[model samples]
Target chain A: MSGKLLQVVREDGQVEKALEPRLSDAQLKELYKHMLQVRLVDERGMLLQRQGRLGFYISAEGQEAVHVGAGYALEPEDWYYPHYRDPGVGMMRGVTIQEMFHQLYGNRADATHGKQMPNHYSWKDRNVVSVSSPLSTQIPQAVGTAYAMKYRGQRHVAMASFGDGSTSEGDFHVGLNFAAVWKLPCIFLCNNNQWAISVPLSKQTASESIAIKALAYGMEGVRVDGNDVLAVYRASKEAVDRARRGEGPTLIEAVTYRMSSHSSSDDATRYTPKEELEAWKRKDPILRFERYLRNKGVWDQAWADQLREQTNAQVAQAIQLAESQPKPKLGSIVDDVFAERTPQLEEQLADLQRTHPEVE
Target chain B: MSRELTVVQAVTDALRTEMRGDDSIILLGEDVGLNGGVFRATDGLQKEFGEARVIDTPLAEAGIIGTAIGMSLYGLKAVPEIQFLDFIYPAFDQIVNELAKFRYRSGGQYAPNVTIRAPYGGGIKGGHYHSQSTEAYFAHTAGLKVVVPSNPYDTKGLLIASIRDPDPVMFLEPKRIYRAMKGEVPEEAYTVPIGKAAVAKEGDDVTVVAYGSMLHVALQAAMKAEEQGVSAEVLDLRTLVPLDEDTFLQSVKKTGRLVVVHEAQRTAGFGAELVALAAEKAIEHIEAPMLRVTGLDTPFPYALENQYLPDVPRVLDAIQRTVSY
Candidate 1:
C-alpha cells in the first residue's frame, strides 16, 4: 500500500525530482508557515478546552498537509465544502485566526451567531460553505456547485473534503456517480486518516483503497502520501486542473493518520495503540515538510523557532480578543431562521423577551 | 386568459413558467427530463428547456436535494422532485439538517432557495409507499416553509410562490387529486402567498380546516352539513409552516367550533398543531369541544386505504360532533 502511494518528499528529507511541484521558495515557506499555524491552533485549542476556557475543540494536528495542500490547490473563486477536520482550508482561504477563535467562543462576532458548535467554520465571502457535523453530506453539495458552474459555462470547480469514514456514506456514492455521469467539475478528496473516531478502516470498508472506489463510477482515482505536502498538492492540483478543463471529477485518497484524539471529548488512548501513535508521529506532516525545506536550503533552526513563537503569541492574542467579546444578543436567537421572521417567530421572541426582561 | 387544468397539468405549467422566466432555475429529479417525470408533471420541459436546465438525475433523493442545496448556494434556484413523498425518506437528513438549516446555521449567509416537490396523500390506492402525507415532518422543522395545494389554480400559484421564496420550501403535491381535481388556472403566472389561508366556503357554525386532498373532502363535508342545517366554514390552509393562524383562529373565534382534517396519521400530524392552536387561542370563544377528522394512527393500508384516509363522511361527522357539542 505504501509503495502504490504517490510520494514527492520522502520521510528522510529527500524528494523525487520528477514529482516535485514547481513552487517558489517563498510559496514553499508560506505553505510551511500555514501548516505550522494549523498545528499551533490545534495545540492552543486543546489547552483552552482543557483549561475550561473553551466549550469544545476539534484539531487537525498531524494531518495538516492533507487540508492545507489540497486547499491551496483551490482558487479563491472556487467553493470548498470542508469536513470538520479541515480548518486549515478555511485558514488558507483567508479565515483569520481571530475569526476562528470568535467561532470557538460563540461570540457575537461569530459568522454563525453560535448556531453551530466549535470548529464548524462557515465563511460565505471566501466561498467556503458551512461545515456540518454529519459525515459525507457535503459531497453531493460540492457536485451541485459544480453543476451550477457547468450550467452557467463557468470554469470554477468545487472541492469537498472528508475522511475515510465518509466513504461509506450514501452521499459519497451518490455524489461520485452523479459527477461521473454528468462530467461535473468537482473534486472529492478523502483524507484517509485510518481512524474514524473509534472505528478503524478495516470495519469502515473492505475496498482495497478509498480512491479505488472511483473506478466503479468511471472516474479517475489517485492515491497520495498524505504526510508529504508536495505530493498532496501535486495530486490536488492535477484534479483541480482537470475539473477546470471540464474533464470531470477525480477522487484523491490521501493516506494519513489522526495523531490526536477525535476531539476534546474523546481519549484516543482508550482504543488507539501507543506504538501506532508513535509510528505516525515519526511521519508527522510538519516535520517532514521541515525536512524537505531544510534539504532545499531555505530553512533554519532560528526561523523555525521564531515562527513558533509568533504563531503561539498570535493564538494567545486571538483567544484574549475572542474571550473579551460578549455572547450573541438574545434577540438574535430567533433571527436568520428565514429571510424575514414570521408571526410565530415574532410571538416567540416577544414571549422570550417578556420572560427575561433583564437580558435585554 | 384562463384555461381549465388538472393539478398535475398546472404543476407542469408552473415549472415551465418559472424556468422560462428565470434561466437560473434548474429542475433535477429521477425521470424529470426524458421521461417527463413519472407522473408527467414535468412533461415537455426537457424538450423545451434542454437537458441542461431540466436534468434527469440518478435515483438518489439525498443526492438530488443535497446537490440542489449546493446549486442554490452557488446562485441557482434549484427545484428537485422527490418522485414520491414516501421515497423522500432517503433525503430526510439533507432536507432537515442541510437544506432547512443553511440559512439559520450560516447566520443568513447562505439561504438555499430550493423548492422540493413531492406528490403525497393516500386516495389513489398507491398504498403505503407511494401515498403518505408527511408534510408534518417538514412543517415541524424550522427554516422550511411547507406548502400543499388543493386545486389546479392554487397548485400553480403556490408552486410559483414556493420557487420564488427566499428560504427553502417543501411543496407537497396532493397526488390523490393530481388529475382528479381540476380548476380554471390563469394563463399568466401569479403567486398565492406562502403563509396565507383561503376560505373555501364561509359559514357561521363550525370551521372545517384542511389542505391538499382533504380540502376537497372538507368542502364536500361542508356541503353535506349545509343540507343538515349545520353551517360549516371550510378553510384551506395551503401553507402549514408559516400557518395562516389568523384565518383559522378568526374562523374558530366566529364559528365557536373547529374540525381539522388530513390524510396523514392522527398522531403528531399537522392536525394536532391546528387543534392546539385553536384550543390555546380561541378557547374562550368556543361553544363546543374541537375535534379532528384524520387518518387512523396506522400505516396507510394497501387493502383499506379508503378507511384509512379521512373522507367526506368522516369530516362531516367531526363537524357534526363539534357543532352539536
Candidate 2:
C-alpha cells in the first residue's frame, strides 16, 4: 500500500480495502462512539467557559475525529505533546475527564496547579509533556524525544499535534527539518482546522498542504480527510509504525474544521459566517460516523441511548470531582520555582505572604 | 598558571567535560551539530558523540527548549542552546512557563533537569540582538537557576555544575568575553556549587558586586579606585537565582557601602533587585545609599555597544559616586 490514509472502514457497511483500514465491526463502532463523547465534552467545556462557571478553554469539538481516532491508535508508552486546543487529544490518551475538569477549575489537585490558564494539561510520567501556550513550540520537543528513543535503542514513537496555523511558525520548519535530517522517530500531525486565531489556512501558507512541507524536510507527507476518524487514525498509525521502525519522521495533515470559536476568548462569528457553519454542521464528524455505524448495524436507538447516558454520567461525575477538589494555594506560585529559591524569589514570596497571609 | 583562550573555547571545554561526564547530557540547537554551533560551541561535538547525542536541532527556540523538557522528563540531561541570549524572546514561553514550572507543577514528581546555554553581554560588534545581556529576565523567573560566568575557570565549573543540577538552569555566557578571556581551568574535572558568591578581592571599603562580563569591569574599576586609596571589595555572583544572599548581606555589613553592577538595561535588572534586597535586609549596614551601576535604559545601541556597556571607566565613576556619597 502507498499509505493507509483511512477515510472509511467500509462503503455502505461493506469493506472498502483501498480507502481505509479494514476495521472489524467492533473497532468501527468504538471510533464513532468516542468521537461523539469527545465532541460533547468539547462543546460542554466551551459552553461552561462562556457561562463563567469555568475559566478560559480551547475547544476541540469539530476536531474530535482528528485527535480521537489518531489518539486511540497510539500505544500507552508513546509520548505526546498536545497543544492548548488539544484537550480532546489528552482525553483520548487516557487522561481522565476529572483531571480535565480540575485543570479548568484551577484546583489544587490539578496537574499544573493554577499557573496556566485553563486548557494546559500534561503528565510527565504518562510521557505526555506539558503543553506550552506558544504555537508550534512542541514540534521540536517531539523531535527531541524521538532522538532520545533512537539513542536508547527503543522503538518508542514521539508524536506532536498542532493546528494549521502553527505551520507559519519558524519552530515548525526548524523542527521538521531537523527531524527529517536526523531520521528521528516522530510523527508530526497537523490538524489543519483551517484557522489560526483568525487567519484562514489559505492566508497561513502558500504550500499545497501542510503535510507536503514535510517533503522539503526529507519526510513523507500524507494528507487525509481529518473529519473522517478512520483517515486520521490510519495515517497516524502508519506514520507511527514508520517512526517505531526507525525509518524517519512523517508529517500528517488531517484536514478538518473547527465547529466553534478558537477559544472562550475568541468570537468566530466575527470571521466565520452562519451559512458556512450550517454547511459544516451537516458534515459533522460525529454525524457522519453515526451514519456509518447505522449502516454497520451498530446504531440501534437502544445502544445510542445507553451510550449517551453513560457518557453524560461520566462527564458529570468528572465535573463533580473537579468541583469538589480544593483550590490551589497561593504559596504554590513560589514553590517549585527552583530547587533553591533565588534571593529575588524569596523576596517576592515574602512580599506575597506579608500582603496575603490569610491565603495560607 | 594563567593561560589564554577565547570565551568561546572556554564554553567548548565546559560542554566537552559535561558531555563526557554524563551520557544523559545531550546538546541541541540550531547549527549546533555539523555547523559546530553558530559560535562553534559544539564545533566537533556531533562527530565526536555522533548526531544521536549531539543533536543539531531545527532553528526553533521554543522547540529547542520544549524538546529539552521531554528529554529531561525522560531521564536525559539536556543542554538546549540559544544562539544568542537576545534571541531567547521567542522561547520565553518555554523558558518562563514550561521549563521553570514543570517541577513545581508536578509537585516535585518531576524536575526539568536541563540547562539552557546562551551567549550574553555586550561590546561585541554584532549589534544589538547578538550582544544584549538578557540574564535578568531569567533571573526574574522563579523556577530557573540563572548563572553568568566571567572567567574560563568559573565557566567550566558552573557549566559542569549546571549540567548536573536536577533543575532548569539558564547558563548565560558573556559573548564579548568568549575567547577574549582565558584562565587556567584545572585540567581535571570538578564543579562549582550553585548559590555561592565568589569574593574576587577583599577590602573594607564599599563592596562592589557584579556578574558575567560586568565582573571584569568591576574588578578593573576596583583596581583603578585603589589608586585613590579606596579599597573596594569585589564580589562576583556567578548564579543569580538561588543567590548567596547571606554572603551578600555579610559583604554589606562589613563594607558599609554597596554597589551592584550588570550590563542589562537598568529598570528591572538584577542590580535593581540586589539594591532592593539590601535595603530590605541590610539598610542599617549601609553608610551610603545602596547604589546600582547599570546599562542605560534604552535599546542596546548597535554601533556604540562599547559606550552602552558598563566599562572599567563607568564602574570607576560609579565607585567615585558611591565613595563620595
Judged by whole-model lDDT over C-alpha atoms, candidate 2 comes out at 0.80
What are the DockQ scores of the candidates, in order? Answer: 0.87, 0.51
Docking quality level of the chain pair in candidate 2: medium
What range of 10 consecutive residues in model 2 chain B has the weakest lDDT sum? B1-10
Per-model lDDT: 0.92, 0.80
Candidate 1 lDDT over B1-325, as tens digits, reads 9999999999999999888889999999999999999999999999999999999998899999999999999999999999999999999999999999999888888899999999988878798898888888999999899999999999999999999999899999998888895799998889999999999999999888999989988999899999999988999999998999899899999999888898888889888999898888888998987788888888889999888888888888888788777
**lDDT of each residue in A1-360, candidate 2, tens digit only:** 233344664323442557657678777777777777777777778778778889787888778888777776788888887877666656655677777778778888887776667777767667677766778877877877787788888898888899999899877886787788888888888988888878899898887677768777788999887887877788888888888887998988887888888888899999987887887777677777776777667677787789888888888898888888777887677766667655666678789989988886
- In model 1 chain B, where is the ten-residue run with the lowest total lDDT? B316-325
DockQ of 1: 0.87
Compared to the true structure, candidate 1 yields what TM-score?
Answer: 0.99
Which digits, one per residue and each the tens of the lDDT, describe model 2 over residues B1-325?
Answer: 3455566776787788677767888888889999998889888888888777887765667778877877777788999899988888878877786788777765565677989999887887878677787777787776888888888888888888888888888998887778775678765567888889899998888899998888888998999999999999999999888889988889988998988888888898888888888888988888887777888899889877778888888788878888889
